[model samples]
Target: MARCFDGNKLVIASHNKGKVREIGELLAPFGVETVSAGDLGLPEPIEDGLTFIANAEIKALAAAKAANLPALADDSGLEVDALDGDPGIYSARWAGPKKDFTVGMEKIHALIKDQDNMAANFTCALTLAWPDGHMESFEGKVFGTLTWPLRGDKGFGYDPMFIPNGHAVTFAEMEPADKHAMSHRADAFKQLIAACFGDNQ
Candidate 1:
């Protein structure tokens, strides 16, 4: 495993502030300097991939090539068993161009209101790409069920209604630190860090 970022500068391919902040917090301990796509003035890619891994790779590659530095990207969404994993990759668009997750959550809740299985989980795929074309991918998921009447004001996207397995509180109701400790993105990022920086502690 690659060990120690050693003050390496990397690009986080995302324009979302929430995502950028979460990623920055995850990478901070490594002494890595992070920059976002919005910081670099890079245009968001079409993200027309058929899978999360593909989309993550696309964004990572784009950022790596553009910034000539190592880059990381994540593609994540909620997958409902009752909905046939629908709004998987389309999670963002389900809220429309305005990125209003409230509407998306309402839509999802309505669609699954009558279903017996409200089981769902959040999935995250992370891709790291180098300017030389070297790349790696990792994935993680947090199994849980959905909830109605979205709770809490914290977290973004579908967090308000997501109740992880074995937990009674929604992600939106949890602190950022608490959420990061068990989130799908956190799981994937832990694998990424392990892959990039082995057990140095």
Candidate 2:
């Protein structure tokens, strides 16, 4: 059986406000008291991992050890098929140090080939680490196509331009609750919940 989360306190090992907020909401129903790494002033560790889960694990472990609490970390990004996943793990870096995704979005648009095959996907890797070093990881994805003239202002990241399959509007066009229902992060969270938090849910 997967290790179950039996603690009431959890540290969200991320500085991104969007991720921290979203994760906190997901954990709310379980009655977990959440604190962000940013709130604790935890330094951002080097994400030297080669893949999403590796990075997630790195962050989770770092925060878990530092906070002496269970830590949950997420590493996610958009992958463009035609571009051969150009910015998969480097998604955040593409935004530059200022975290300006608009610049990253424009760069993606400029590099797209065969606009008709603008196939892409948002990928997420979620990892939970304990201070003792044990860990659990889960991953999820949402397939979609790239859209231009980025729409809506509701979501952060590349949400303004990516439309999920069978959806008319970009992720940013949907309400927060709506996006949470089907986002890549939510997908990963579902698995994490089912495996480690099923009893609580």
Candidate 3:
């Protein structure tokens, strides 16, 4: 059995405001108070891991130790099949030091414009780590195709151009409630909640 989250306070181990906001919204129902690492002035840990899960764990574990509290960290990115799953873990880096998605999106579009397959998917790996080094991890994926002329500005990152299966609109075009219903993060959260917070529900 996985270890449950027994504490009321949890640290969201991320510096990205958008990611912190989205995660905060998800935890709202449980009445779990969340404080971001950014807010706490916790230094961002180097994500040297090769896989999403590893990266998530690195962040979560670091925060847990630093804060002496349980922490949740999420690592996610886009993978394009035509590009050999490129920019998977480097999704954020592609935007350069400024973390600009527009530049990253444009680079991706340029590379695969002539390719036949625009197949892409968003993958999320969520890790919850306790101060004692105990941890639980889950992964989720939402497949979609890449589109040109980025459509919406509602969502952060590559959401403006990726349309999930069975959806005609891009992620950035959808409302938060709508996107939350079928996002890679949501999928991972389902498993995390089921395993770690089932009794709280």
For candidate 2, what is the lDDT?
A: 0.95
Candidate 3, RMSD to the unseen true structure: 0.6
What number of clashing residue pairs does each candidate have, in the order they appear? 0, 0, 0
Per-residue alpha-carbon lDDT of model 1 for 28-90, expressed as tens digits?
A: 877778999899998898899999999999999999999888889999999999999989999
The ten-residue window of minimal lDDT in model 2 covers 110-119
Segments in model 2 whose C-alpha atoms lie over 4 Å from true places: none
lDDT of each: 0.89, 0.95, 0.96
lDDT for position 81 in model 3: 98
| Residue pairs with backbone atoms closer than 3 Å in model 2 (clashes) | none
Question: Each model's TM-score, in the order given?
Answer: 0.95, 0.98, 0.99
Candidate 3 wrong stretches, greater than 4 Å: none
Q: Model 2 clash tally? A: 0
lDDT of 3: 0.96
Clashes of 3: 0
Q: What C-alpha lDDT does candidate 1 achieve relative to the native structure?
A: 0.89
